[model samples]
Target: MSIRLGLQIPNFSYGIPVADLFPAVKAQAREAEAAGFDTVLLMDHFYQLPGLGAPDEPMLEAYTALGALAQATERVQLSTLVTGNTYRNPTLLAKTITTLDVVSAGRAILGIGAGWFELEHQQLGFDFGTFTERFEKLEEALQIVVPMLHGERPTFSGKWYRTESAINEPRYRDHIPIMLGGSGEKKTFRFAARYADHLNIIADIDLLPGKLDVLRQRCAEIDRDPATLETSVLLTVILDGYGAPSDIGEARSGRAVSGSPEQVADEIKRRVLDVGIDGIILNLPTHGYTPDVITKIGEALRPLVDA
Candidate 1:
């Protein structure tokens, strides 16, 4: 398949006056499905970013949101952009994903990473460990989670996590794709090369080619086929009537594929051709989720893949 296009639903309540945001969330999910988007991702955050608002301001639990979206949409795959590994116990997380997969009929993608955002971690009383410790915990968590998903009784006694004979029974029909999210060369990409079925990276169009090259090298070192590891980009799109910048040059801020549909499509095509990326997860603020932008993107971009 050609590159897949997905949407990331930012969790902020962008001035949409509503007692509840669930309906808006559902509306965006429906729009993604209607727009021929491949996946719809939700953020896993307990608080709005500091300047934005309060701790409990306009946020939805990731798993709960996914379950709701499971009931809402028919085709678009649902997942978190990356769940914080420190948020839940690995065993429970495995079961949760298995349940979500079953509910979504095997359309759940588990994108996980070592939890960052020290402020949130501290406030929530989740252990905001040293960076090295967090990485170690993440590695152990994956070891436990991946095997359990495959119906294996996982046993591990790492420094961070100790589990004994924990099993996830009646695994889903298809193995849920494990997507590792991060661009750390030493530990993140290394783990992705070893275990991930897909890799999510944030990249400007300029940096993408180099990052892909590094990933390929890592894959080779691990005796893994780079091509087998599906590459995906997380992009932020700011679509206004004024149109995007005319410069078709390198991207900054790790945000690529922003602009008018034609301009965005051209950038996307370049990324696919040069870096072999198979999918893009577009991050849209609430304003950018308007039907006009969605329709324009779908009409201008879907043919590149569908054709």
Candidate 2:
């Protein structure tokens, strides 16, 4: 999937009552679909991340939410911004995403990463291995996952995972697109070139061009055309009319796009797209749940991404 302009719903802490949460999520997905967004994404985490909110803050499981969202909206693609590779067995993940693709009628993108978030791993009793170990696990996971998604039964044994002719059935498509998220020029970039259909670069705005250069080099190492892998950046946006400027912290402002919708669009063009990045995915963690705000943001940014 070529995600020119995507909306990621990274926050779920609207002040509304608990019963209203899924309704709020549905509204955001429906509004994003209506406003010409190509995809809608959720974070794949058991708890909220550090910059977003406290760990106790409300967060829904990604696959369950996306399954429900598949029924709630039409046309827009669905996925996690990046599923933590450490969360589930590779075979199970393949089954889950293939099920999502079937339910969403072939609009599922498997966005994944080498899992981080040490606290979640600690509290949830997951193995938080060393950084190098995590990448190694991720590489092994992909070897099984990519084949399973392609309607192949792969019998594999590895350091971290093992699968015996694992079968994934009821697939909506012969292949579901895989998008790898990260800025690692060594491991992530090389893996994206090797197996992924898209690469969502997660780095500072200033560092993007250099990252892109290294990504090309990685692709060249494998003799793969860089264009075969689509690229995008994730932005934490604070629209001017939605909330006060102080809602954003000083640290995040370096990567955030905060301004009027028009100005936000302009800045994204100058900062992300003009840097030779293919597209952008925005998350308004503080204010995007409001349907009107989602519509406005989508209206302003849609033209920039439309071919």
Candidate 3:
């Protein structure tokens, strides 16, 4: 999966009425594809996130939205940035992605991790367990999901998940790329070394070089080439219409940066790519879902990472 540049549509409130919601979503995706983004992503949650908006804000179900996106576009890869493992049964999640692959002609990416978002779990009736338990659940989930994505029928019983010969038919390819998104070295990095095709670093930028080194060690210990697993970082940027910044100091927090396309790209090159990360995923958080914003950001970002 050579997705060096990705666009994440995390907000659904387009200031339009409900009937025009999905039409707007499809339009942004098509524009991004034309503007040179390699992948398209959405958040996997029932409610809007805390920093973004109210709990009742409009948010589409990830798979359903991706399915609609599949019919609307031809080339851009579609996925959630990371799926919440607790939201669905492991076997069912595997089936959904495979079905997506069949529909999109093999452009689905299974981006999953230990489920976060406590309020969503409480309101939605999914169990919100301790951190260790969530990782344990993620570990068992991969046991079932990995093989099924490979078109295998294996019976496995674990404390968290049990599958009796789960088989996913009509698979578009022998493998759908699995991207594990998080910065937990003990659980997420180890799992990535073993199972993931992409590791999206979600931690602070200054600490990333150390994390990358640790990930290399994790790969080496497991007898896997560090280079085999691809990497990307998620950045929150407030883009200007033109590719220049109003003020760049607001981005010092390192995780979320604010700037125009050029400023954001320079920061990404300095912090993420120069530190040996491969790709970049941008979240506009507020001003996204507009065609011109998507096109302008992609125009500056695609070449920076592609270089």
Best by lDDT: 2
List the lowest-lDDT window of 10 residues for candidate 3.
Answer: 242-251
lDDT of each: 0.77, 0.90, 0.87
Q: Count backbone clashes in candidate 2.
A: 0
lDDT of 2 at 145: 95
Query: Once model 1 is optimally superposed onto the true structure by TM-score, how far is the C-alpha of residue 139 displaced, in angstroms?
Result: 0.7
lDDT of 1 by residue, 113-217 (tens): 998878888877999889999999889999999988888888889887888999786666547889888878888899999988888886566677788888999
lDDT of 1: 0.77
- TM-score on alpha carbons, each prediction: 0.90, 0.97, 0.94
Give the winner by TM-score: 2
- Where model 2 places Cα greater than 4 Å from the true spot, the runs are 248-251
Better of 1 and 3 by lDDT: 3
- How well does candidate 2 match the true structure in TM-score terms? 0.97
Q: Give the winner by lDDT: 1 or 2.
A: 2
Cα RMSDs of all predictions? 3.5, 1.3, 2.6
